[model samples]
Target: MTGTVLVTYGTTNGSTARIAETIEDVLRKAGLTTEVLAARAVASVEPYDAVVVGGGLYAGRWQKDARRFVRRHSRALAERPVWFFSSGPLDASASERDIPPVPAVRRAMTRLGVREHITFGGCLEDGARGRMAGMILRSGKGGDFRDFAAIEAWAAHVADELGRA
Candidate 1:
């Protein structure tokens, strides 16, 4: 079951990148070889057996780079185990209702028949560039909302799925 997994992410202020690295660690610990790279840095998906794509959310949408990554490799990704995650919904308050996936993401998932999609809370830095964007967005107050336990649990589930495959 051991094989290469690519954990690619698009982050606005680095929260999603951190989440991607955590997933990479989980896969490695499960005896799978993993490479965590920025979504924009991934020129090809041919090197990996499975793909984990992640990104931060802004205005109810995933980062552009993440969307582009999926669009560019949708066919190849459909032939492999693929997981999608979004870093958003700052806290529990924001999670009370189900957030709809962006139109592009929804369409991509249907077209690619992606394996799974998860949404995790995002972190925002006070002085970071994303913070400025958030201010303009009129989103929630800034703070780290990423739940490591939830992230780890999701990663474990992905590993189990890959193992079964």
Candidate 2:
């Protein structure tokens, strides 16, 4: 039912944080008390009833802070409702494509007992990426490719599912 939800993320240039913010809106609207924070800043999950984590994908990997967050809290996370996501993929229609899991995420999910993970369309704005990432992002593929509608829908679904908690 309605309870406290923690929505935290790790982002390189803030895109994944934005996703976490949007998810917070959806969850709050669905009657849950929600808070958003950075993965590294989250000191504990003892105050939360559910947890949602997301991160930016770089070089086929999720943010280190996020991975560490999982490793550090796997036991607690496994005892609650948890969901994971990765935000990267320059294709404008990438949300429609299949989401292949990163090896680290696979282990994290297994350890945390989470079954569903999403790969959302990511945003790549100028001056927001590292040198090499900027190069790849600037290769005629950079833009705000995030599918907000899909993201909102996913958030709504999560809220509904958590309502049973």
7, model 2: CA deviation in Å? 0.4
Q: Write the per-residue lDDT of candidate 2 for residues 1-165, one digit (tens) a residue.
A: 666899999898998999999999999988889999999998988888889999889889998888878877887889889998889887855577768768889888887788578889888887885886778766877788788898999999999899876
Backbone collisions counted per model: 0, 1
Score candidate 2 by TM-score against the native: 0.94
Residue 122's C-alpha lDDT in candidate 2?
Answer: 86
What TM-score should be assigned to candidate 1? 0.90
What's the lDDT for candidate 2?
Answer: 0.86
For all the candidates, what are their Cα RMSDs to the real structure?
2.2, 1.3
Residue 32 in model 2: lDDT: 88
Q: Kindly report which residue pairs in candidate 1 clash with one another.
A: none
Q: Once superposed on the true structure, which residue ranges of model 1 sit more than 4 Å away at CA? A: 93-100, 130-140
* Candidate 1 C-alpha error for residue 160, in Å: 0.8
Cα lDDT, model 2, residue 77? 89
